[model samples]
Every structure is written in structure tokens, then in C-alpha cells.
Target chain A: MFVTLWRMITFGFQNFFRNIWLSLITVLIVVLNLFLMSLVSGLNVVGQQTLTAVRQKVDLSVYFIPTTSEQRVDQIRQELLRKPEVQSIRLITRAEHLQELKKSAVDKGLVDAAIDALGDNPLGAGLVITSKTLDGYGAIANTLKDPKYQSIIEDTGNNFQTNQTVISRLSLIVNRVQVATLWLTLLFAVIAILMVFNTIRVAIYSQREEIGIMKLVGASDAFVRGPFVITSLLYGLVASILVTAVLVPILSLTNPFFAQFFAGYDINVLGYVREHLWTILGLEVAVGCGLSVISSLFAIGRYLRV
Target chain B: MVTFEHVTKTYQRRNVGLEDVSVNIEAGEFVSIVGQSGSGKTTFAKLIIAEEKADKGHITIGGWNITHIKHHEIPTLRRQIGVVFQDFKLLPKKTLFENVAFALEVAGERATRIKSVVPQVLKIVGLEQKMDRYPDQVSGGEQQRVVIARALVHRPKLLVADEPTGNLDSINAQEIIALLKKINEFGTTVVLVTHNREIVNMLHKRVITLDHGHVIADQQAGKYLL
Candidate 1:
């Protein structure tokens, strides 16, 4: 049995090299198949990361008129903080608010001159409120509309308005893209699988006479099929390695671009791949080997009757 | 060594391969099956090796009933019977040595034994010098010789040569027939299926003549009667 198995693998490699062009074509097909799949998978991961980051950055701020006393503002902060849904409430005092705007201003001289002209800070103090979820923000919005705090809180729906709109639109776009890509990936996978299957079928059909001769020479079905399976396995392994080699450099090159787009978010796809190297390779190999091997088996089956 | 009783086979539905053929080839006999094209000469050889299952009836080879031989068992049956085709059927990519050794390798023969045996078999067909050459690198006769070498590796009890000389010139055909005769002399049953009138007349062996899927004549020490 060991001898037979060893011969099968040896013959498989022998045959693979024999038809160099065909072997190369098959391997490239496998690489293309895997590359497309991994590319879409990486895109999905990045999309999810961007969406989550945007959602986390969405916060509601309740500004008080400059006349509201510190005690009154702190009281409203404490009251909002007591709500279980509110994750955090930080007080942005008028002085602190002025300092923030001035630091962020592109023209520091203009901002300093304006501050001197005003003499007293005109910026309003507010409580920046965050929630565990986007839905929790809705509850917080309702909580602020209570009649008791109406005197101190100037606007309930003012600060989070544009961000809420931006986030909802962004979420919609990302979700649509994810759905489309998932479908596109599935469609591409099916087409590629069929193409591989047909390629193998053609290869086997060309060798149909050889298969018949092998059987007549007393080779069992396993003996004949063993070599083909090994050849396909090599195709899968080589393609997976090539895809990884291709993907690592590609994702690495794209890292800078992704970082610029999703600023402060972890968009390092290469890092993601390395972190899940085993799973990624495992899945790639499984798909590659699984696809080619199955294709080869089905293709060679028609000729094994002898 | 081979028995066919009321065997019938057809292709699709209309094309008949063999029709109610009943024949028994004794052990160690040199029998030539002669017929024109589409006369079921190849079908007789295919039946013995279980390459094609009969649509009806029974077949036995060396006392084993193979009328309905299971697909898996076909290999074991074929290993015991050598078959040579007119096309040579050598793997084009494989060298002469690899081609001959393939038979044994598929049978799970050890590498050491294969290394020793393949050359001996190739030597029998006077192809030992060209053993490393691929099939396409050699002449048609040499390729057919390699097929004969492969068939001989198992020391099979029955050797079926279906149009082994069909692609060969007179000289090469004579050489292949001579080789088959030599193999038969070594106590292996040789079933030569061909349409060569001159070769058949020369063999003067037991001949089964087929026509349109039916056996029209069986002659002991037969000449090319067709």
C-alpha cells in the first residue's frame, strides 16, 4: 500500500511536469480564484471596522446657555449620568470649550485676537454624552426632553444631528456594499469553481486513453485516481501560497491608503492576515484543494470505467 | 482458459458488439480470432479482460466466473491477463521503461523488483537500449513492443493481442507475431485478434472467424478462411 501510494505521488509530480503548460495554467486559475475570494474577505473586514469606528465616534452633546451656573450644569450632568444607557458624560466648561476651539483653529493669531476682543469667553459649556449603542442615543435624547431640566439644557437635538445623519447614511452605504460584495463573491466563487471543473474535465478528457490503458495494465481505480488527486493537491497548495504571496504585498501597499481613509482605526489588512494566518491559510488550502481535488475526481471518473 | 457462453453485447441500442457467442479457449493454446472491421474481433478480447460486460450470458476465465465481474475486481482480473492494443496505448509522456514498469507499479510491486523486471521485459522486445525514450520518441513498432513488454510483466496466464500488428508494417508485424508465438511457447495462452489475412494464414493456429457480431466458423489448425 505504501509502495503504491508513493508511486502515485511520484507519478503525479512526474505527470505535472510533463505537461508544463497545462500545469501552469491550472495553478494560475487556482491563484486567481483564491485571490478574488481573499480580496473580498479583506474588504468585508475593513468595511466592518470603519462602520464600527464611525458608530463609536457618534456622541450627543447638550450645551447650556453661558448664563447657566456651574452647579446647575453639573446637576444636569449628574442627572444624565444616572441613566443606565449613558456610558459617559464629560463636562465641557466655557473656558475649556474656548481652549479647545482655539487649539483646533488653523489661524492661531486670528483666534487669539478674537479672544482678546471678546474679553470674556462666548462659547457655551455642555455635557458630552456617549452611549453604549447608537440606539441608546435615542433613549438619551428622549431623557433630555424631560420638563425638569428644560430650564438649563438649551438644545436637546442640536449637536448630534449632522453626525446622526452622516452615520445613518454611512451605515447604509457600508451595509449595502457588504451585501453586494458578499453576493458578488458567491457568484464569482460559483463561476470560478465551474471553470476549474471544466478545465480539469478537459485535461482528463485528453488523457482518457491513458486512463483506459492504465486500467487495462491492471491499475485499480484508486491507483489511477491517486495520481490525479495528488496533482490537483499540488495545484491547490501552490495556488494558495501564490495568493498569499500576492495578497500580503498588495494589502501591505494598500495599508497606507486605508490608514489615511479610516484615520485612527486599525485598517492594517496585512496585520489582520498575520493575526489569523492559520485560519486564512487553512481556509485557502481547503478551498483550493477541495475545489481542484473534487474537480479532478469528477473529471477522471468518466474515463475510469475501463 | 477462457469460456464465453451465449454472450451478447451492444453499443447504445443498435450497434451490436457480440451476439450470442459461445467459445472456449483451452489453456496454452495459440488462438487467432480473425474478422473484417466491425466484426466483433475486439469484443472477444475485451470480454476476456472484462473491459466490456456482456449484455447477457456468461464468461469464465481460468475457472473464475466473470460474466458480471464487479468494477473493483476488474483490475485483479486484468492483472492476470495481458492486453495489447493496435494503438500501443503507451502513455506518451512516459519513457519505455516507465511504461513497462507502470504495470507492475500499479500492482504494488516493489521498486527494487520493478527496477529489475522492467528492463528484462523491455529486453524481450529488443527495446532495452531505448527504455529511457518516451513513446513518441520511438517508432510505432517500438511503442507496440513496449505495450507487449508491459503486458508480459505480470507473466499473465492469458495474453490478448487485439490488432497488435494493425499499425505495423510487414516486417514489424512479423516481428510482433513471432514474439507472440514465442510467448505462447512459454505456456501462456495467446489470443491474437486481427484482420491480417496473410498473418492469419501463416499462423495456421486455431482460428475463430467472426462476421457481423456472430461467429461464422471455428477451425482447429485454421487458415485465414474469411
Candidate 2:
């Protein structure tokens, strides 16, 4: 049995190499299918990683009323930090804000413009509220605008009209991208399956007479189907290696650019994408093997009657 | 020994294959079943191999009932009966040696057994010199000889050849008949199904003639009688 199986394996490889053009065509189709799946799945990973990092950068800045006493502002900061949603809070005084502005200015021209336009450093002391979770930021942002804080606070930066619209639109675009990628992945998966199905069907058609003759010569059913099964397995194995070899470098090349955009948060955006390497490979092989086996089995069962 | 009792086969539910066929051949007898097209000769050959099951009646080869044989059991049954078809049935991609050893491989014969039996059979078919050649590389007669060698590896009790020489020239046809006769001389029952009237006439062996699914004649030392 071992020798026969070994001979069958060798025969399968011999047949594959003997007809190089057909084998190349089959491998090309499988590679294209697996490549599309890997690309879609890989991009989805990066997109989600970027979105989560963006959400972690959210913070609410509560500016104190200009006339409020320093002690009153400090008392409001202490009260706000006690809230369950607040992960951390820091108070920025007007003088500190002016100092930060001067440090951010690249030249004397901007600093002189800022001093003349404002006349008297008009910036107020504000409380910066960082939330533990992005989902809870909206509720915390709303708390800063409550009537109870009207005596101590003037306005919250988180409630600015432009900032609200920009954040919501970015979230919306990310969600749309996710939905679109999912649909595209599903569509490409179906096409890949059909492509493999037709390839295997054509293979079985080409081998129909040979299989029939083998059956007539007292070859068992397993013996007759053995070569084709091994053929599919070889196709899947090769396609998976090709996909993984190509995808890893592609992911690595794009990681740095993605990382720079997500620098404000603690997340290693690229690390998340790289961690799923085995999963991507597993999915590719599973898809490749599954499509080939099912297609060949169904086609052979229908065509090879004997 | 092979026996077909009241065996009937229908193809496509309308076309007749074989109808109410009954016959018996003892061990070591070389019998020729003769018929023209649509006369159930090929159908009778397929029945014995369990390729097509009989609609009614029993088929016993070497005392094993094959009428209700399971699909999985067909392989073991086939291993016991050597079959040669009209097409020669040699795998075109395989060499002559691999073609003959394929039967033994399917039967799970040991590598040593295959290595031992294959060349011996090839020598018997007189294609030992051409064993390395492929089916396309060899002549039709040589390919048919390879198939006969493949059939003999099992040492089956019954050898059923359905027009084994249909595609060969007269010289090759005679050689094949002689080879079958020689095999019968060694005590293997041989059943040759053919439309070659001349070869059947010359054999002077037992003949079973079928016409439209019914046996028209059963005679010892039968001639090519229509």
C-alpha cells in the first residue's frame, strides 16, 4: 500500500510536470483567487487597526470662563476627574497655552502676528478630559456643556462645530470602507470558487477516458481518483506559498506610512496586521484546497460514470 | 466455471442489452460468444464483470453469486475474473510495463510480487523487449498484448475478452487467439466474445451465439453460423 501510494504521488507529479502548460494555467487561476482573498483580508486588517488608533486619540478640552478665579477652575478640574468615563484630566492655564503657542511657532513672524492679533494673550485655562474608550467620549464631551458647569466653564473644544463634523465624517467613511471591502471580498471569493470549479471540471473531462479504462482494468475507485486528488492538493500547496511570499513584503512595505499616521496613540498599528500572518496563510490554503477538492470530486463523479 | 442463468440487461430503459440469457461453461474450456452489433455479446461480457447488473436472474462465477453483488465488492469479484475490452483499454500515458502492473497494484499486491509477476507476464505476451515503450509508441497488436498480460496477472479463473482483436490485423488476431488457447491449455477458462466469423470458425471450440438478447445457438465445436 505504501509503495502504491508513493507511486501514485510520483505519477501525479509526473503528470503535472509532463503537461506543463495546463498545470501552469491551473496554478495561475488558483494564485489569482488566493491573491484577491489575501489582499482583501489584509487591507481589512489594516483599516480596522487605523480606525481603532484614531478613536483612541479623542479628548475633550473644557475651557474655563475668562473671569473665573484660578481656584474655581482647579476645583472644576478636580470634580470632572472624578467621573467614571474620565481616564485622565489636566488643567492648562492661559500663560501655559501662550507658552505652548510660542514653542509651536517656527519663526518670529508667526509669534509677532499672534501677539499683535490677540492684543492680550486671550486664551483661557481649560481642563483636558481623556476618556478610556472612544465610544464613551461623546457622553463625556456632552458633560462639559451641561448647565451645571456653566459657572466654571466657557466652551469645550470637543463640541466645536468643525471638529464634530470632521470626526463623524471620518467615522462614516471608515464604516463605508469596511462594508465595501466585505462585499468585495465576498464577490471575489465566489469568482475564485467558480474559476477553480471550471478548471477542475476541464481536467476531469480531459482524463475521463483514462479513468474509465483504469476502472475497467480492475482499479479500485480510490485508485482511479487518487491522481486527481493529489493534483488538486499540489495546486493548493503551490498557490498558498506564492500568495504568502508576495503578501508579506507588501504588508511590510506599507506598514511605516500607516504607522506615522497613527503616531498619536499607543497602538502599534502595523504590529496588528503582521500578527495575523498565520491566519492569512491558513485561510489561503483552506480556500485553495477546498475549492480544488470540491470541484474535482463533483466533476469526476458526474463525468466518470464507470 | 461460469454460469449465467436467466440474466437480462436493459440499457436506457428502452434499448435491450441482454434478455433471458442462460449458459454454462466448465473450467478450462475455451468458449467463443459470437454476435453482430446490437446482439448482446458485449452486454454478456459486461454482466460477468458486474459493470452492468442483471435486471433478472443470477450470475455465478466460480460458485460466487454476482447478481446482487455490492458496488464495493465488485473490485474483489473483478480481481477474480480477468477482463479485456474491445478498446484494448491500455492507459496511453503509461509504459507497457506499468500498464500490466496496474492491475496488481490495485489489488494491493506487494512491490516484490508486482516486480516479480509483471515482467513474467510481459514475457508471456512476447512484448518483453518493448516493455519500456508507451501505448502510442507500440503497435495496436502489441498494445492488446500488454492488456492481455495485465489480465493474466491475477491468475483469474475466467478470462473474458470482448473482441480483444477488434482493432488488430489478421496476423495479430491469430497470435492473440493462439495466446488465449495456450492460456486455456494451462487450465484457465477462456471466454472470447467477437464478431470475427473467420477466427470463431477456425477455433473449433465451444460457441454461444446471441441475437437480440437471446442465445441463438450453443454447440461444442460450433462453426460461424448466423
Candidate 3:
């Protein structure tokens, strides 16, 4: 049994190198499949991060009357913090709001004019409220509308209807992108499978005479079939290694661009890829080897009758 | 040590490959089957190796009836009988040594046994010096010798040569015939199928002549009579 296995392994290498061009073409296809799978996963991570960042920026602010005391604003801040839906609430004093406006005006070269016109701080104190989810925003807005706080409140940004519309539209776009990526991934996967199948079939067809000779020499089915199957598995294995070698460097180079794209979102695409490198490569190897083996089995079944 | 008892075979389209053919050869006999094209010569060779099943009757090699041999058992039957074809079906990429050793490898022989037996068989066919050459690197006669060497690796009880010299020139054909004769002298049954009248006449051995899927004559010391 050991002798037979060694012979099969050696013959498999002989077959692989003997048809070098065809083997390379098969490996190339497997590489493309694995690369596309990784690309889809990367896009998914980036897309989720971008949507979360956009949603995080969509918070409501509760403005207080200028005469409201600092104590009252602090009480409102503490009450909002206790709510489960509220992620955070920051108290923006009138003076702090003026300072923020002045910094932005400086960027536009209108700082001096804006400060002269508003001698005293006309901006009201406010609370900036963030919720854990987009759906929670509506509940938080309703809670602020209670009569107890109406007297001191100058304006409550309770545009729930408009906010809901914007969130739904964003959700629609993100969902569509995910769906399209899935379909594209599936389509390419099918094409890659067919190409591998045909490549293996041609490889086996070229060895028809050799197969006949083996049968005449009294080779059993497993002995004759072993070399071709092993050759295909090698194609998958080598392709996976090639893809990882190429992908790691490419992903590293693109990390800065991805980080810039999701600047304030705290999304670390490179970190994600690094953490899941083995899992990603493992999935690719499984897929690559799986396709090659199945293709080889079918091709051998059709061509190697002996 | 081979027997065909009332065997019949018909191919698709109702073409007759063999018709109620029955023959027997004792141990260590050299027999030649001669016929015209489409006269069941190739079919008879195919049947002996179980490449084609007989439509009727039975074939037994050394008391083993193989009329209804299962698919998995075909390999075992072939290992016992060495078969050679006119085309010399050697793997083009494999060297002469690898080609010969392939027979033993397929039968799961140990590496030591393969290393020992393959060289011995190649030496018998006078190809020991050319063992490193690929099939395409050798002449037509040398390729056929490698095929024969491969056939002898198993030390089979019977060797069947189907038009083994069909692709060779006159001198090469004579050499192959001489080699087959030498192999037969070593107590192995040799069944040579051919249409070459000169070689057949020179053998002066038992000859079975077939015409249209039926045996016309079986003669001791036959003279290639049509």
C-alpha cells in the first residue's frame, strides 16, 4: 500500500509538471475565485462601518432658553443619561457653543465679524443626544416632548418623520449594495467552477492513451484514478498559497485609503483582515480544493473508463 | 492452460465478433491465431483479456471460469494474462523503466520487488541499456520491446500478443518474433495473433485460422493456409 501511494504521488507530480500550461491556467482561475470572495468580504465590512458612522452623526439637540439656569440643564443631562436608548448626552453651555461657532467661522475668515455682531452670547445652552440605534431616536425625541420640560425649552429638534425618511433611504441603499455584491459573488463563483471543470476535462482527455495502457497493465480503478485526483488537489493548494501571498501585500497597501474613507467611523478594515486572515484563507482553501477535486472526479469519470 | 467452450460474441448493430468458438491449449504451448481483417482475430484477443464480454458460452483460464466476470475482477484476470497491442501503448512521458515498473506498481508490489523484477524483465527483452529513454525517444521496435517488458513484469501464466509486430519493418518484425519465441521456451503459454504469412509459416507450430468469426482450420505444424 505504501509503494502504491508513493507511486501515485510521484505520478501526480509528473502529470502536473508535464502539462505545466494547463495546470497554471487552472490555478489562475482558482486564484480569481478566492480573491473575489475576499473582496466581497472586505466590501461588506467597509459598508457596515460607513452606515454606522452616518447614523451616529444623526443625533437630536435640545436647546434651552437663555434664562434657564445651569442647574436645570445639568438635571436634563443626567435624566437623559439614565435612559437605555440614549448612548450619550453632552451639555453645551452658551459660552461653549459660541467658542465652537467662532472656530468654524475662523475657517471661513468670518470670525471677527461674527464676534462683533453677537456681543453677548445669543446662542442658547443645549444638550446633544445620541441613541444606541436609529429606531431609538424616536423614543428619545418623544420623551423630550413631555410637558415638564416645555417651559424652559427653546427648541427641541423633534423632526422624527424627516429623520426616519433619511434613515430608511440610507438603509435601502446599503441593503441594495449588499444584495448586488452577493449576486456578483455567486455569478463569478459559477463561472470559475465551469472553467475549472473544463480545464480538468481537457487534462484527462490528453492522457487517454496513457490511461488505456495502464488498464492493459492490470491497474485497478483507484490506481489509475489516484494520480489525476492528486494533481487537481495540488492545483488548489498552490493557488491558495499564491492568492494569500498576493492579497496580504495588496491589502496592506490599501489600508490607509480604507481608513481615510471611514475617517470618523472607527472602522479598521486592515485590522479586521489581519485578525481573520486564517479564517479567510481557510475558507478559500476549502472552496478552491473542493472545486478542483469535484471537477477532477467528474472529468475522470467521463474520460478514464478503465 | 486456456479454454474457450462454445463461446459467442456479437457487437452492436448485430455484428458478429465470435461465433460458437471453442479451443483449448495445454500448458506451455505456443499457438498462433491467423486471420484476415474483420475475421474475429482482434475480438478473440479482446475476449481473452475480458475487454469485451462474450455474448454466449464460457472462457476459462487455468480452471477459472470468466464468462460472467464482475467489473472489479477484471483487473485480477488481466494481471494473470500479459497482453500487448500493435500500437505499443507506452506512456509517452514515462521512461522505459518507469513504463515497465508501472505494471508492478499497479498491482501494489513492494518497491524492492519492483526494483528487482522490472530490470530483470527489461533485460529479457534486450532493453536494459535503454531503460532511461522515453517512448518518443526510442525507435518503433524499441517501444514495442518496452511494451513486452511491461507485459513480462507480472511473470504471467499466459502472454497474448495481438498483431505485436504490425508496426515494425521486416527485420524488426523478425526480431520481435524471435523474442516472443524465446519467452515461450521459458514455460509460459504464448498466444500470437497475426496475419503475416511468412512469420506464421516459419513458426511450424499449432495454428488456428479464422474466417468471418468462425474457425476454419486448426492444424499442428500449420503452413499459413488461407
Top DockQ prediction, candidate number:
1
- List runs of model 1 lying over 4 Å from the truth: A64-95, A104-125, A130-136, A148-151, A158-167, A260-266, A270-279
lDDT of 3 by residue, A7-84 (tens): 889999998898788788878877887677667666766776777777778787778888888788999899989999
Native contacts retained by model 2, as a fraction? Answer: 0.49
Docking class of 2: medium
Instruction: Evaluate every candidate with DockQ and list the scores.
Output: 0.86, 0.63, 0.71
List the pairs of residues colliding in candidate 1. none
lDDT of 2 by residue, A17-131 (tens): 7667778888888898888877777666666666666666666667776667667888888887788878888888888866877888789687878789978776678777777
Against the reference, the lDDT scores of all candidates come to 0.86, 0.82, 0.85
Given candidate 1, what's the lDDT at residue A283?
A: 89
Full ranking by TM-score? 1, 2, 3
Best by TM-score: 1
Task: Tell me model 2's lDDT, rounded to 2 decimals.
Answer: 0.82
TM-score of chain A of each: 0.80, 0.74, 0.76
Q: Candidate 1 chain A, which ten residues in sequence have the lowest lDDT sum?
A: A155-164
B-chain TM-score, candidate 3: 0.98
lDDT of 3: 0.85
Per-residue accuracy of model 3 over B60-143 as CA lDDT, tens digit each: 988899999987898899999988889998888889999998888888888898888888888988889999888999999999
Worst 10 residues of 2 chain A by lDDT: A155-164
